[model samples]
Target: MRFLGFCLSMLPIPVIQQAGLALDRHLGDKAFEAQLEELWSAISTANDLVSKVSTLEEAIQEIAKTIEASPTLEAKTSEFIASLGSNQKEFSVLTENQSYQELRSSIVHADISNFVAIGGSTNVIQNSTVNSERTHLHATDNSKNFVDGTTFQGSGGAVSMRKITTQGQISVQGSGIGFGGEGGIGFGGGSSISFGGNSNEVSGNCPSCNELLRMDKRELHKYIHVQCHKCKSTFPFKLPNA
Candidate 1:
């Protein structure tokens, strides 16, 4: 079922809607119809279209009703996309069953300016300057936050469970910044600076139990193995020179 959703999510919205409409017209089994509805809901949420469409099934119904009533569908879609850009941000309210894969892909492709995800697991932020105040303000996931020439700036901008992988440069500046979470990773190939008064930290999760392992930046040089108190398991870590 997950694989089906994965494949369908990659299809163009128009194609999916057409397939759904065809099924609606020809299919009759209630069980099969229910399954198709569930799949549509999952795909809609995954594609970050739930905000525009409460459910793909509903959207298809609306399309059926409007297909003959209008001829400017392309213009409407364009206007919708343009309006989203006006906010200069992408936001999602996710449940535990959801991941941020589709949304992350959008960020990477579109160079999205800001993002916010609430209550989702395995969230990722990459290849863009994410507003610290907006991204994952309240969520617990095995998050991997990357800074490829990106800055996680602002007061109260604390990234937990983060493995700062620098490709260009990363700066975790501001007071009251701390790191602690389940799992994290960021990719880059440049120098990183962690300063601005009490703001030098690193963290990652245990491979065995996914428990958070955190430490101050000063202790990174001597750091070799991180032990998870929850599972009594240890993992090796190689720190970049801070």
Candidate 2:
């Protein structure tokens, strides 16, 4: 029990101090110290029970029962700390699937220019920048069925564009995950420009192709050059400090 006391003493001083303060508020310093000592003894007993238990599940059940039966708040706190370690171990095991590992590896190795993962669990970009004439990005998950026994599972889509200036147009659409479930969009800085969907006609015409220029407010901020789909000719437009 001396070793157990030492281990408990080595825990974060602030946590123990906070607990002591709480106990002192109700039980006084002398009673709090006595309760803390008793808690260490309970922890030692629980450790011994864990060693004697046949299986991990049995040990957890027994430890939970012991914690529930504790008379002092200190003992209950010690039990809760022990439970945190067990929960962390269980979490590691739950995430250690071979398929998940493979999926993670594939995503890590993939050189994704325009990524669209549909109808499955997949990883998305954390941060990225795109500089191009026209950037058309779309990630749609329309699959009715899911893999790996996960019913009603939806696909995830993410794009991060920083200091992006598109010459022509940028169309981004991500729709339908699990039965009318919609995907989300997150943009930072000047990347918040929206290009396609509904078009509002601009005042000018294309210089090269002589076609009418049509765009939205978001597009007008990002695109300095416009392209005509009819003639496939690109033309530059003059904007104020843009």
Candidate 3:
């Protein structure tokens, strides 16, 4: 029970002595003090109750209506104060389901120039959890997954974009975790990237017999339909990017 200290009346009465002596005669000491305490107590109690309740709209509003119908400032003040207190508690209850945690891990610094961000807007996740009540964690689970379990927003991921070297061909090698465009494999920049498991991108040097031709990932599957001019007469091989 926090005591709301007495507020001196803001109205400027004659400061000489006791200007309200006449009015004091009207309301006896016991009656005035008791009435003030009653109003204060009611307001404070309402405030406490509202905060604890799951739903405060009905209860607080009822108190407000009761105060409005009353024809005095003291009653209105009590109701307003009660409403304020109750609201703090009420909203706290509503957000009880929410959780907060600080993940403890070291930051990563890596070069990610090779990776490209695909076209279109990305998912804006307010919060994410793994196997928790909410639903899913974005990016961590799969590069393919986007907002609300929907497909990419216009192929919206590193899988769609590819960076062209100033004067070098894009290379690939079919090995661990497959390949597409290296996620976060740039000349310099530590941006997190995730590529598809099997991307169909092929490359080869033109006309230079001594030059190299290469393919990786799903291309490793037998009988590659390579649409390249220099590599052929259609040369068949395995583990080029390797």
lDDT of each: 0.36, 0.33, 0.27
Which segments of model 2 are wrong by more than 4 Å? Answer: 1-41, 46-48, 70-242
Q: Model 1: per-residue lDDT, tens digit, 1-242?
A: 33233323433322344334433443576765565465445444444433365565444434333322445532443332222223233333232333332122121111122222233232233333334333322333322223223344435553432333221222232323223311123433322323222234467778876766554444445568755533445678877565
Q: Look at candidate 1 and tell me the lDDT of residue 86.
A: 30
Residue pairs with colliding backbones in model 3 are: 51-89, 112-186, 112-189, 113-186, 114-186, 174-217
Residue 212 in model 1: lDDT? 67
| Top lDDT prediction, candidate number | 1
lDDT of 2: 0.33
lDDT of 3 by residue, 1-242 (tens): 12221111211111111213322442455654565567656654646542343444444444444445556745446333322222111010000111111111111111111111122112221111111111111121122222111111111222112221111112111111122223222232222334332233345563424445433333245454433322223454444555
lDDT of 2 by residue, 1-242 (tens): 23232323323322243333333353445654565566656655756774476665455444445555666734556443332222111111011111111011011111112222233212122122222111232223321111121111112333333322222112333221111112223332322232232222234676765756443333355567765533446777765443
Ranking, lDDT, top scorer first: 1, 2, 3
TM-score quality measure for candidate 2: 0.20
RMSD of each: 17.7, 25.6, 29.7
- Alpha-carbon runs more than 4 Å astray in model 3: 1-191, 194-208, 222-232, 240-242
